[model samples]
Target chain A: MGLPVSQILLVTGFLLILIGIWGILAHRNILRIIIGFSLIDTGIHVVMVATGYVTGGTAPIIDAALGKADAAANAVDPIPSALVVTAIVIGFSVTAIMLSFAIRLYDAKKTLDIDAITDSKW
Target chain B: MKRVCAILAVLMFAAMFLGLVQAYSERQARSPLAEYYLTQVPRELGAPNVVTGILITYRGFDTLGEVAVLFMVAAAVGVLLGSKKEQRAKTSSTDGKGPSELVRTGAEVILPLIFLFGAYVIMNGHLSAGGGFQGGAVVASGVMLLILAMPASKLDHGFLSVTESLAGVLYVSIGILGIIIADGFLDSHVLPLGKFGTLLSAGAIPLISALLGIKVGAELSVVIDRFRS
Candidate 1:
């Protein structure tokens, strides 16, 4: 009757990615850039989980109602969700590293302006 | 002009992404491989949660890589910010007033409960929706709360690093044990599969999941400690 929820999620994720990129490009503050990066990471994670969605499927857990034989016809894809779990953790680690770098940069130059830290800029 | 160009570039990227999404035809059980995991995981591994099964068993090596990546990040962050000279110089910056008594009491009261919930999530990972990563993050949040509330309290860096390393070694050893005792590296058949949907079921998956939870929790605590005062 309408576009599936998966497509909607995909679109929403795309929009988030765009917003993140806009933030990164339009903002000069180091904290905002890191925030933009984290947003992009989240958008990617959402798109990943959305890619695995089935039209009318349940979680890929085998229980009383969902037996082994019927699991194939019912369960959503598990691979992407699992990968997304990994992606989310890695994203957090990367964000931490980025923020630490930002802190070090601030400590050195006493500024958070992206343009100001351009000693090596070509 | 640069702002206009950035907007145009982002719009172009969005247009391409929309085109890709429009062409993507959604399906129920799209891949034969996913179908195999869906049906075979329950029967073969006795793990109810196919995602958990696949994460800790089918694609266990990938998970190992992910863990390694996190470990590297933690170490990298430490090296980046853990300078002794900087530590001495930054004492004045971090000596802000402590959190109020109400917040301190609240954190004290809720810390153990948060730990319990994190354990529940980790322990039931093989049988439920939550898993080691989610549980580990929950635990990290509790650690974060303690850091924020007390401010004077310190997480034992030595204990955390030792535990993290020990867990990493144990995880690898389990994988190697699987290669010897079962089909291949990280194979869950190293132990008895027990019964389906039970806590003790799923062979080595639950064990690995627990080890993962501890390892991730420790690593995250280290990251938080490095970032904190």
Candidate 2:
């Protein structure tokens, strides 16, 4: 194969991070910025899961397909998958908080533009 | 100037990560730690889903912390947008028209199915790809759908919070039970590890998954409900 699935996923995740950063820096709308933040979060999750992949490994589950005896050679790492589960949940909570903040800001200034809030400007 | 900076920053990150492209291609063997979990979880925990076994028992403390973080977010979001804007959000800016008859009818038809599916996912977590968080999200999405269908409907905040807190307390109680009886905190061995690859096979895992599903579903529903207004 030219490139393995894991590497492709890894590269795609990195690209998503860069795109998210550019979106965050270049956008003025708070909603767009939040979307960018979510993109970055997703990118990081992908990278972490990709890092745990083995060359020809299946899921870590020891079902009928992969017996316990063959688990070591056949299974991908479960740690990253478990951590990503936490990461994904935390990411959703953070996104929800960001959205609530965005709405609060919109309510106060009647605008979603970051430039509209002058009190926080350095 | 901002555009140039954005492009330059993206380019810099791209260049920096190019090394990863090469490093990731080589075949990698399982670490000793991974190997340990892979073999031991099935034998010791009797949960076919190794990931769920790890998440619910092995790294249970971290999962507890994650749940705490979600609880805080729900509370913070409540504090942030829960007051003063009720009338505004209730009125809704969408021309005051509710969802269409098709959506309402569809929601009425499929809402129960969605809830059942979420519960199944949570319950069968140890034997399958589903788990508490994923299944809990599925449940919350059902709540979201309910919200979407019935704009004027009100969620029982008191009931949801009670469910969330009660499930959390019970979860911790189970963990403590593990420490008292089994190897350590949140150990699955507290309950008898039944036959492998069945719904009730894993010791305490199905119970934990149920508790997690209930807690997360309640918390996320509260968050979603608060966001409604």
Candidate 3:
């Protein structure tokens, strides 16, 4: 059997997630970690939306020319597409908040290295 | 680096194999809300874009929450960074030579086009792929270009704040109007639906999109202004 587009998208998404995780875990810079977080979010959104796509499905919009039979024949789910828009907005806001925090941290501490940001002795 | 690459390669291979198997096994599974939203929501809400119907009507509370988060972030950033004395001291020390004439001219030429495109995106959202958030981002980027190309001293913080607050209040009030006039909060049929696939159709979707566009545009400009040194 031929490889499905969904499978390919899913595999690429998972790989991107792993890379993002690795970046977050291994990087010393706080900005790098934030970038990693964004990457992970993007990967998850891609996978979530890709899962909604069927092998042979039409766009969600109704066309009168298609008639009832053709409309019922193949149509991909629109719910995930709708949900993904929300997810994207939420992701953007979160990224903005995180970046603002990073800026504040830099302003107070004068450095971006996570290791140097420790205020309390441990 | 080599070890990391190797591990990544192995993980990729494993994930590909697993996804193939999973797709083969789970081919028959169906999403419950998928059909419900597609058929029922359009008929009840009278909005052609099911996505818009779901976002602004069925789950509008979530949209309100998202807008609140953005507002909170803007407020927090302002509070954290708003030290007028320090800013004034810093500005005085610098020579304050304004931006180059070329940059200012370029911004004057480009800003109108950007705003027009943003409006187009918001207006055509129901018919096409884009919506409020994307259009809002585009508008913000345009505002950013102005800040970059013009002198910082020329940027009016008061006007920006007024625009931002008004847009935000309008957004919530529209939702409340849905409650008062239509089914509930953010009901799409609060206004006339016009006809499907047309610019004036989808009732409140275009209105909400325009509101979101303005709010996002103003908020992001404020954010960019905060970081400009």
Candidate 4:
């Protein structure tokens, strides 16, 4: 059975998510964990955009090239794409915050290892 | 032991995703709302890009929230990294060697072009695939180039802050004006929807989008600067 492009995208997105999860769990350095989290964020974006794809559909734009009626029939879902823009910004913001925290932690402790900075752990 | 655990976790995730992929199907216009937007955007908003129309007009509040979130993050990062001691430590650690002549010249030449492209993207948001968010990122990249290529030359933090605040205030004021003069808050019907597919079309959408682009660009620049120091 030939796998659909959407399914292929989904699988790739999921694989990225898994690799990210593994990185976050396996790595001891704080930066590695942050990198993993970003990978997961990217994976989610890919999955979301992929889910909106329609076979043989064009972008959701109306112009002289594509009439309004034809656009409604052929355009892919626009909501996911719109939402993904916001998601991307929010993800960037979160990543920035995490990196700042990492920097502060490194400055204070002089180490990036997660295990070494566990004085607060009970 | 951790390696084994990681492998097991990855395998489990792969299995779960495989199950999901098995049940997935791709089709055109799955949701009724998607159909509605695809149909009504051009007729109502006079814009060709339905995603831009939805982002800046139909669901503007979410976009506002996004801007607010970025603002908060910038603020938080500034506060987190603003310690005088840390600043001194960073400055003292780095040697005073600036970027090479070639890099400086390239950045100087490319910066204006990046700004122009970003402006174009924001201006034509209603008519094409790009919009405020994407354009804002391009603008931020320009700022990033400045930060990297000319680290000695300081960006005017006060100016960036003022621009960000003014753009944010204007965006909200436009929304409030929409509530008074048009259908509702953040409504794009405040201005006459000009010729379809034209730059002037989509009422306040293009305006709001431009403001959003400026705000996002400034906010990201501030964040990057904070991270640098």
Best by lDDT: 2
Candidates 1 and 3 compared: the better one by lDDT is: 1
Kindly report the fnat of each predicted structure, to 2 decimals: 0.86, 0.84, 0.25, 0.91
lDDT of model 1 at position B28? 55
User: Model 2 reaches what TM-score against the true structure?
Assistant: 0.97
lDDT of 4 by residue, A13-64 (tens): 9888988999898999999999999999999999999999988777888877
Q: Candidate 4: deviation at residue B85, Å?
A: 5.8
- Which regions of candidate 1 are displaced past 4 Å? B85-95
Worst 10 residues of 3 chain A by lDDT: A65-74
Give DockQ: model 3: 0.39
User: What TM-score does each of the candidates earn?
Assistant: 0.95, 0.97, 0.83, 0.96
Per-residue lDDT over B94-150 for candidate 2, one digit per residue giving the tens place of the 0 to 100 score: 568789999999999999999999999999899989988988999999999999999
- Tell me the deviation in Å of residue B192 in model 4: 1.2
Q: Model 4, range B1-229, lDDT digits (tens) per residue?
A: 8889888988888888888888888774558989899988988888899999999988999999999999999899988887765566576458878889999999999999999999999888999988888899999999999988988777788999999999999999999999999989999998889888788888998999899999988999888888776
> Which residue pairs collide, candidate 1?
none
Best model per TM-score: 2
* Separate clash counts for every candidate: 0, 0, 0, 0
| Whole-model lDDT values for every prediction | 0.89, 0.90, 0.73, 0.89
Report the C-alpha displacement of residue A32, candidate 3, in angstroms: 1.2
Residue B167 lDDT (model 1) = 90
Q: Distance (Å) between predicted and true CA of B35, model 1? A: 0.5
